[model samples]
Target: MDEHTPLLYPSPESPAEDTNAQCTGVSGVYHRIGLRLVGSLIVDSIPVTLSYILQNSTQTVSILVTGRLGPEELSAAAFSMMLAFVTGWCIALGGGSALDTLGSQSFTGGNRPTDLSIHFQRCVILLWLLFIPVAILWAFIEPVLLAIGEPARLCKDVQAIMRILIFGAPGYIAFESLKKYLQCQGIMRASTIVLILVSPINLVLNIFFVHYTPLGMLGCPVALSITYWLCFILLILVTLLSPTHKANATWGGLQLQAAMNLKSCFGFLKLALPGILMVGTEWAAFEIVALAAGKLGELSLAAQSVIMTTDQIIATIPFSFGVVASTRVGNLLGARSAIGARNAAHASALTSVLVGSAIMTAMLAARNDFGYMFSDDEDVVRLVSQVMPLLASFQIADGLANACGGTLRGQGRQHLGAIFNIIAYYVLALPIGITLAFSTRMHLGLKGLWIGKSICFGSVRRLTHMILGQVIGLFTVGTAEYIVVWLGTNWDKEVEKSVVRNAEEAKRRTLLEQHE
Candidate 1:
């Protein structure tokens, strides 16, 4: 398709053509399609957003509960959780994203009904295996922390927290994997329902264990472990007991033979490895900024922590948009409706921009007071207020990146998305951020760190463009470039690839069954 092609042109087979025919004008037809897709995306995105919000809240509550003990204890809990996110949680989310591509497509591909379940099973097993090393690392993290020159006391505390948290890692990984299993089948609310029921229980457990019980600071991890396992179990029960059996068609009981097939494993990894890097690189970049914040002293660290926490929560909005986009696009591609997939992709990007702008406005409005929710210290609070504008400006670019990234995932181009992230954050964003953050002449401190990040987000205006010039020009361009690339996509080509992918899976299943 070329730039002159209409954004919502109905393919000859599309039912949308009937609706388009009834419209008074071509513009009217496009308008209706835009509204329909945006509305559907919003409806699907809400539950996903809530699920993420509730999921993050469980960990945030743990830190809040432990914060009452002492600063040192709170810091250790936060630090340990950060480590958990970077290692175990990142592996779960990043690796599980493979299913965002495979599971969603398989569910709608029609060629093999069991492909979704088979992919899910393989993902869970692979992620569990991946976590083994992380578990081992957590078990011995104290020495590693000390070797890196962390205070001996803080290292011990972090070690204690991580060791207990380790037992719960598999449950968290499995739960994330299962959520994808259900979501790809259009069961968007199951995980949300599970989290809604479990989040309050998690809060009560944290309060009781940390305060009413004898465990004290250690109780935080105990509660977290129990909560993670409870979420996993509840999700399973929901799947099995749903009146509709929303997942039943795609989930053919455990297929250990197919799941463990050598070629199947390699095929899954082809999509999964880049997915890990696509997500992990961005997460690691932020973690690096957090570490750098520590060097600016306690106040900067505290402010950075609060901003990062708030950003994570806010990030769910765009992330949910991406999730829904990935699923919707995959489903359309699977059904061989290229027009529908392309329209959905464009709608998601447009909706994200609208949602992101609203978020930016809210953040800007609350800039001065938002910091108070996380800290009472005047210095940290002030520093946070000063940094809020940069953070606020980032929401739009962040949303665009996520929406476009989702489209790429749907297209099975995660490797391309991974390349963008590596280039955007590491090669472009970080070096600039770190230099300004640490440079003696600049003395930008926390603000410098965020300035570099804001640039990476490509939110800076002409002033920044003029100041930074070509050295930062590429970094300032942002994820909008992805949208341009997406516009050029051969949607029909993508549909063919999905068909081939499903055909391959069907052939593999046939071979595996014959061998058995």
Candidate 2:
């Protein structure tokens, strides 16, 4: 056997002996495990959450600048953001979905997994290449906006923003690739540190470009692009400092063959496709809501932005938990302890609920203050406040779905998650929400959009949580139960085999002694 392979089987042990040490629940022995898991998650989640907030603060600044320019500019910025999201950010999610799986898998595999860095580099190159055609399509953005009945003036502003953003697509993809690399090595905290470092720089750039330069709305995109590349560089530098990256065979060089292996490359694309669509579909649904509101007029569009900004900020909380849970669950699964993976998944899911509930309470209590953080206008505040309840009510479900989805992805079950997302977002949420937001005469208006989102979020949460929980029980706990049962049923047979082997070894030893 290879030195790394363990071929020697252990002596057949009685089930009773094992059961004597098996943890019953979270009472005594399990309690410490639970605390450690939860504590680790919280510790990791904090920096990540702060990074997300700081990163998004640039958008806040952009919106503030746009707000000063009046409604048309604000609408233009919103339109431009949606376009940037679809073409660039959405693709990263797809590529990143693959990264999350492969990265975690490699971490589990040890030194050999380190060689997978070449694969990561190859994937990033492929994504950047793929983005070229998409970038070229930026020229048609104005026509598309016009086709959608967007105001001519707003369409022009959106075009400028799109042009600037498209220029930076390669950098954006690179940044995402680096993030996955760090995340997979169990050194995810590094990316958060880089994000924190880049955020203030981004803010200053945004201010300079908007106020000092002639870029105006275009400066927002310019600033963001610069910050993104900065974030990428920082991650790459920090990651290279890690011992694991040092020990890896795939760290350096432009070995075209190794860097561009098609078979493995295609596999990654396949694994990531569904995740890309799932996130894209959900994001597209929101963009549609914003578009529809824009057609309604500036106030509706502004209101949507306010609600969305808040949602995006708050979303980091659930997202932080999900990322940690995914890593933890992936680690346990890769370790081959199905029971441990199940426990980790369950703990993560429950922790999500607790976190979500806390966020829900906080948001609900602060519903009155939701808009003031952005603007002093009574109309925007009133509209946002009216929609706050719907948004707040769905927080727990949203958090649960995010956490469970991460758990599932960590287990290489992203396809299952993608299906749930399609059914929830497309079949249940979009149609219903759009109708309510546009057609309803209940005087709810944008509030209807919020309600529809809540409904979608709630539906997805219940379905995913229930499905994931059952899966964990069947795969993890059920596997453990089978092992326990088998150990009990065939204890005598195993013991006999062990004895026979031992006797044969003794006979060989005596024969060797006589020959000597």
Candidate 3:
């Protein structure tokens, strides 16, 4: 069928009458839908969460294995991984997010199923093209670090590791893109399976390369590179050989034309650029906090490391929730079910709050002892105990923001989320944090940094009021604003937009196909 042909499903302008019928019993229907959506989101999020935890462990394992080499080796591996997280990993996450919008929509949009494949191809091509400069930068990073007045020996070590890791950058980005491809098709467990199969191998490889093979400190990256490529290959095999063929139905093979489609490439970037900003801005802000923590003295820095590491692990839950929300909302939109999309968004927000609160309670209960998990230093443990409450307080806000951000992504409104992050973190939270952290009078120290972040994450109460007085917390403000916006959204309009978006893509594909 030509692209101009009508979708097999009801058009947005003429939604199925049953949707209207359900709206008549709005309260009961919505309650049922919310429960069902929450259950589905949780079920979907578990595998995704496990996948992230496993994937993250690979890098952490590398650090653990290599850190035993010496302090300098440990420092180099840690620094190199941080740089990789900000640059290549962020690009993979943010760049691949475009597929979260387009691919999910396409899969349910009733266009040719291959449109999902086309979007995946476009994402892979763009991200790889983007990685070229990153690789080049890694090759020359030592000079940049030196220019910044970093220790020369440390810079040299970091540069060496980065250069080795560069070989695997494409594999990392491609694997992320492929995960999105499969995820959009409802194949959520594939990546988890791949990681389950690869994690042990990764650990073995790290040991073999670093100790047995004589590669020394550099061996960690080599093992990592091999592990990344293996993950990508295994995922590809899973897609090809799966009994269900959910992913296979969408895979149209490696079409050179799809990758080379200029219009499609630009379309992907439209969402991707904002997605990059959404991820990078928040991540960079945390990194900035980490750098500032280092300036506070070794004790404070160590405490900050403990807190940050725990936060990253805790964050995977909301992050997974966001992922599931994005896919569900996008699928509902593509299917022209405005009510379903709206319910899913609400359910996602509710789920995040409930989950975040539970996490916060647990963290609070463990605050006194949590630091012992990372370090035995009394000073560091004491400082971490002091700061844990502030961190715990904002979990709900973080969860809400993530859920809302995911909803925005599914609705093709990533730019709005990016804007909120920039304003909240950069303009509001960071400035307030740095000021309080270093202020001669306040003397809040590590607490000040977290307080600033907590404000951005949504802590609003007597403490915040006492600190800032009339000023509202950014996290509270941003998440509230996001909820308001979502409440005000016209899901019918969103459905229309999704339909129009898919139709335009189909038209473009048709023209390209005809020309070919």
Candidate 4:
């Protein structure tokens, strides 16, 4: 080989360019991207998860600190936390999915991408606009709780918590919007850094305000609200300083035409609304199980809470993988690299399955240990131990469903996804599970709940795999291969032709010179 000759790999134009090339089959590049995606998921989830844990943690903490408080305080804290979780999570983060969809398209489109500032502005407008009714809902929360069947004393406590938590809505939404912007820009490390710094601060604030300070229950939301604003500020500060953010025109002045583009803004709402409902319905369904467990009495409720917390932490692993896949697939699709999109989906799905299986095994091995750590009561530990196997059993199927849903959402097929989830979870899975839970007499009251959960999770997994199979067929596999083969063959032929032509010309010149 010539010293100056460069090595060439098989490409679509010259050879078969494997769709797998874009996948994590490559070493350093694959792992680096993987780490970034996983890191983003962990970092992004920390505050939210901590918020989830902290909010829940506050109930017990409140009960502990507020000595002699009756069931009223407990129930109020519960309702407040519930309202906060549903609103903060479902609205703030849910509404921000518009960024995952649009920001992705913009990022990949690069040259002709929509104005980042306009997208940000429009989302902000829509987010704030959506905030009005939810805030109103927060305002009338007492009457609503009263109407729903909550005890009068409990209603008062709930009302106080609602009013305080409600104040955090604007901060929650604003911070979430900023997070989406940073994530879309692939600048999640900054968000992570900020959150790590602020979360402990929030925790300390939660303890001090709830236990010692005059704030009481109100202090929790106040602390959480402060952290949310802190997150937004840090993200904005990072956005201003990052070269990548500036390069993407994320800091561009907002054009009224761009920001007020109702057509485009509504387009985002169209994608986001169903996406929100898809996940929300599933969450609400699970909450129902928890509610049902509450009916089983305090031991059952506490046991379920402890189990659910551990379960949720485990659940985040697959969901996090889904997040990574969604971002990767969305970016690829937005680039119009259909082959790459397909490969990314396949890779992500496979990763979820393997990871899920591994987690399940680990959970099974440590099932008794996990339950024992949460409670010293033999009865609670024994009950939790019985339930662990069921949770462990559901992991694989659950992971597949979660990961596939992410892929579908990234593909701009959220409508189909929403329908599938509705049918799979609500129509089919939940019904079967509820029947097994309530009607079937296995003497497994709480375990029965998990039995239904297992069935529902499994059904969704099967459905997702089938849907993915059909979608995978639409990928540009044959076309990409054809392009690779044709480019290679034709380009080689042209080179051969040119070489021959040059050789003939050189010979002719040599003979003519000899004759002269």
Q: Which ten residues in a row have the lowest lDDT in candidate 3?
A: 1-10
Instruction: Give a tens-digit lDDT track for model 4, residues 1-516.
Output: 211111111111332334344444234324423543334344443443343344334334444443334455556666676666665467665666666666654555433333445566667778778778877777678788789787887777767767676666776677667766655555545555566666667667667776677877666666666666666777678668777666656565655554654556677788777776776666776777777788777777778888787876677666655655556555655555544454455555556566767877888898776777878888888788778877777676666666676666565556655675577567755665556556746445777676655545433334443223321211122123222222332223322332332244334434544776
Could you tell me the lDDT of residue 365 within candidate 2? 91
Which digits, one per residue and each the tens of the lDDT, describe model 1 over residues 1-516?
A: 211222222343767655655655325534655665677777788999999999999999999999999999898988888888887798888888888888888887756677888999999999898889989999999999999899999999999999999988999999999998877776788899999999999999999999999889999999999999999999999988765444346778989888877887887788888988888888889889989999999889889988888889899999999888888788778877776777777778778878988988898899898888988888878999999987887787777778888888887888987887787678767888888889989888998888777665553243357136422342245344554646568888999998888888888888878887
Candidate 2, clashing residue pairs?
none
Q: Kindly report which residue stretches of model 1 are placed more than 4 angstroms away from their true locations once superposed.
A: 1-13, 17-32, 212-214, 244-248, 375-379, 458-479
What TM-score does structure 1 among the candidates reach? 0.90
lDDT (Cα) of model 4: 0.59
Q: Please, what are the lDDT tens digits per residue for candidate 3 over residues 1-516?
A: 211223222233544446544564336544545454566677788999999999999999999999989999998998899899987898999888888899888888947888888898889889999889989999989999999888999999999999999999989999999999887776788899999999999999999999888799999999999999999999999888765455237777788785677887888899998998889888889888998999998988999999888988989999998898888788789988786777777778878878988998899899999889988888888899999988887777788888887888888888987887787778777888899999999878988898777766542333355256322344455356555656668889999989998998888878878998
Measured by TM-score, the strongest candidate is 3
Off by over 4 Å in 2: 1-33, 66-71, 243-255, 295-302, 440-443, 458-516
**135-204 in candidate 2: lDDT tens per residue?**
8777567888789787799888888887888766777788878776666555656777787778778778
Question: What is the Å distance of residue 41 in model 4 from its true position?
Answer: 10
The global C-alpha lDDT for each of the candidates, from Candidate 1 onward, is 0.81, 0.64, 0.82, 0.59
The TM-scores of all predictions, comma-separated, are: 0.90, 0.79, 0.92, 0.77
Better of 3 and 4 by TM-score: 3
Query: Top model by lDDT, which number?
Result: 3
Segments in model 3 whose C-alpha atoms lie over 4 Å from true places: 1-32, 246-248, 458-479
Count of clashes, each model: 0, 0, 3, 2
Ranking of all candidate structures by their TM-score, best first: 3, 1, 2, 4
Better of 1 and 3 by TM-score: 3
